[model samples]
Target: MGEENKIILHGTWASLFSKRVELALKVKGIPYEYVEEDLSNKSPLLLKYNPIHKKVPVLVHNGKPVSESLVILEYIDETWKIGSLILPEDPHERAGVRFWANFIDQHVLLSVAKIWKSTGEEQEKAQEEVLEKMRILEEGMKSTNLEICANDLGLLQILLLTTFGSFKAYEEVLGVKVLVQENTPLLYSCVTSLNELPVVKEICPPHDKLVALLNIYRQNAFKSTTN
Candidate 1:
């Protein structure tokens, strides 16, 4: 909030990664300016801030740019040092949070992307990976005390919030249930808990709109695969 700590987040409305950064900033009661960027156009400022990725959810604090959503989440927690810490104080617990967050992004989201982006054998493989990863995450939650509490806002919780938030849209688009309650009750419970929170609700995109967007993206992805 101070002049020396002016924070700006560059992101797009429909970007899950962008939503992660916005959710973190809002949860911490941190004041920041939001700048929405068109990924298609790739603004020069976005390019300058994050040349390697040239992506959104770039947090610029004190004029310094921080790229990558997971990295930015921890950065937010570390820098503020007030309110409830999003990352746990215990190093081991913190490590677990980071590990699972990465797993969700890399294994879960990436595989889910392939489901809608690819077809035939590749898409079938992705669907299997999605289920397997979900099982792993459910077991991971059961092994630990991690749950999606709005007040806590831990790294894993925040990441799951963004990922699970998109499940409905993905399901509607792909005609498959990725986060099934029968198979992964613990993970399903986390999704339910996340939805109960007002912060999570506010952060979630319009469900119908998201489904339409996913369908459009799916069509485009399918087209690319064929061509």
Candidate 2:
């Protein structure tokens, strides 16, 4: 393929999965057009390309579509070998990184999503699960303190940033309140550590915005049940 046949990404700005792909491309110095998507009414192109998951962070290289954020990251790393590499060169190290990445998606992302979407007792239960999961992440970070891999960010740091970003949304959209020192101190510490990093500080979302968003969701959820 020629220079004009470069990759194109379809995703949403608020989506962590989409953010992952964007960060991977930015780290690799890969230039590609970005198409913001509305998952509520997905674009025909998105449905056509990623018919399986039909999710964002779909990468099209030379018109070939690759869905799933992690899969797309691997594609970007393999296709463009310049700048920072996503996976480690060592096979064992690479496996470790992959393991955490998957863990973030399954354990953190999954639980946090429920925190935002559920309400009443359901929401409370989900919050309990989130606190437990955050504890697990906090322990992992304390134990390994994984070395910075690419772009001065470690595997745990990336997971923390992405997972916290999602939690910020939950705290913003749902009335289920969370205080750093009160509810989940370890998770709060995790967020503080990740925020201290220069690169992460630039990429992550603001706390105020998350809180404001959560207020709106809470009001809406209240109205839905009451009225």
Candidate 3:
């Protein structure tokens, strides 16, 4: 690869979206420079690359930039054909994967955010929303006929395992169990299997680190809302 062809990933370790891109890159065994950004002080290159959203997990390939974790994942899979494919070959199956990935991001993750960011009746309502969304996801995934163990690491698997893999963080931070085995059995089983993969095993930060990160994140969210 030429100097200009070098690949770089600008991201923050605290950002789940950044972790998603990192997971895809590691799973593919792709070599790239990882530039960790302080969300409070984003770099000039990141802003130049992603002027619109100006967020981390911005992929810089051959001097060109690609923003958004999902788009970056697809780009990586298409650009590099090595390792396990992130999306299925079958068109229908591929569509299902994409749909569920989006659902997890838009629906499931939003409800989870509500849990940490609110309290009292609102937080309780958010907890209910989390279970309801997960229930719908569990049933919808049944039609895909996927086994409880995720042998193949597709887009949906990447999103779920990386996001919900921090299941304990939700429980610890909220003081109430939200993503438990009894509530989301299929997800629990699949995340366990996914964690066994060599490319991505035990990827979550330590418990103390996780708790500290959650506290910092919650504080930032509160600041943003109050501002």
How far out, in Å, is residue 190 in model 1?
Answer: 1.0
In model 1, what lDDT does residue 97 have?
A: 78
Candidate 3: global Cα-lDDT? 0.82
Residue lDDT tens for model 1, 1-227: 78888999999888989988888888898889999898889888999999997888899999999999888988999899776688888988788877778789878888887888866787778888899989998788668766544446777777777877678778888877788888888777777777777877887889888888888899999898789
**Candidate 1 segments whose C-alpha is farther than 4 A from its true place:** 119-125, 148-151
Positional deviation of residue 88's Cα in model 3 after best superposition, in angstroms: 0.5
Q: For residues 54-120, could you state the per-residue lDDT of candidate 2 as single tens digits?
A: 8898999888999987788787777777876677788877887787777778886788667656778
- Per-residue CA lDDT of model 3 for 72-178, tens digit only, reads 99999999999989988888888888888889889998888887777789888989999989988988888787443567677888888788777777678777667
- Which ranking of candidates, highest lDDT first? 1, 3, 2
Candidate 1 vs. true structure, TM-score: 0.92
**C-alpha lDDT values of all predictions:** 0.83, 0.69, 0.82
**lDDT, residue 224, candidate 1:** 88
lDDT of 3 at 37: 91
